[model samples]
Target: MTDAPILIRSVEVLSDDWATLKKFTFDYRRRDGTLERQVRQTYDRGHGAVILPYDPERGTVLLVRQFRLPAYVSGHPGPLVEACAGLLDEDDPETCIRREAQEELGYRLRDTESVFHVFMSPGSVTERLMFFIARYSPDDRIGQGGGDRHEGEDIEVLEVSLEGALGMIDEGQIVDGKTIMLLQHLKLKGLMRASAHP
Candidate 1:
């Protein structure tokens, strides 16, 4: 994958209130030796990390339910279930995830395995997420994490059976993309299994 055939023309900042949104105009060389002018807008909310906490012995996964204004405005009934995640800010992906784990789920995960990296919304969002999974036990619980109140966060923690969680997906209850992907990853890798079902 080489970008030698592409040439950038200009970039304009459209909005920079809470996040940076920019419009880019560029020239692209087609396979037929033709140049094309294209324009696109991208919103950059910064990169982040997501972690799914699993307890294989009990076949359980930890998730969070929190209100998302965007989802609500887009027609969601209420809060959305999602993996514990946060923006990297200036920290590394691992560090950011660990921080978010403690802040969102009250678990201080000892070790985490990176699953993959993905752009959650590539078409209009310039944000990439590093996906990770960690094993946690009851002993890992630390604080009563519901997020910092001052940040306008009112998160509700959920401890769900893997089977039940998957059912939620089929039932349209678990609509968060990142959370769904991580849950499917666990099922694919045989990381967590419902003993009765299989």
Candidate 2:
């Protein structure tokens, strides 16, 4: 709270089962002369990185389908179609995404360009995500990646037309927030050509 509008009065650990959940008690000073105390719960699971691997030559994008318990409990019928992503465990965003590319997508990505960093769920989650886009070719395929089974990751790789991926969002087939953001970001940046095909 050095230069923040709020001062942290106290912090209590609410849960540490998987991610660390804490309850923060803070005193917020208004623009006037009023000071108010507020409490907020935040979950911290560390930052992560996600990349959309697109083949400009083939006009296709590499995605992954995986089962998410939260999505299932929240009422999704089955697994979700999403970009290749992983937590930046002990590495930087670039390195983390490179490793995830191989572990989840079976692609060997060399150079990557970052699009942006975002706080997906600011109100309740204390995690930041880095979004990236990288070009790929058919020769970059290295192995059959489906993620680590011991970690409960049963991933299925998908190679779909860029146009089809955009259409899936309209049809509710792709609902992952970060994935949607990355796809739209590319569209807005004029990187993906709707007519490009391989």
Task: Write model 1 residue lDDT over 1-198, tens digit each, in one string.
Answer: 246676778999999998999999988789988888899999999999999999998889999999999999999979999999999999999999999999989999998999999998999998999999999988999988898788888989999888888999999999999999999999999987564422
Measured on C-alpha atoms, candidate 2 has an lDDT of 0.91
- Per-model lDDT: 0.91, 0.91
Q: Which residue segments of model 1 deviate by more than 4 Å?
A: 1-3, 193-198
Positional deviation of 15 in candidate 1, in angstroms? Answer: 0.7
Deviation in Å, model 2, residue 1 alpha carbon: 10
Alpha carbon lDDT of residue 5, candidate 2? 82
- Angstrom error of the Cα, residue 8, model 2: value is 1.0
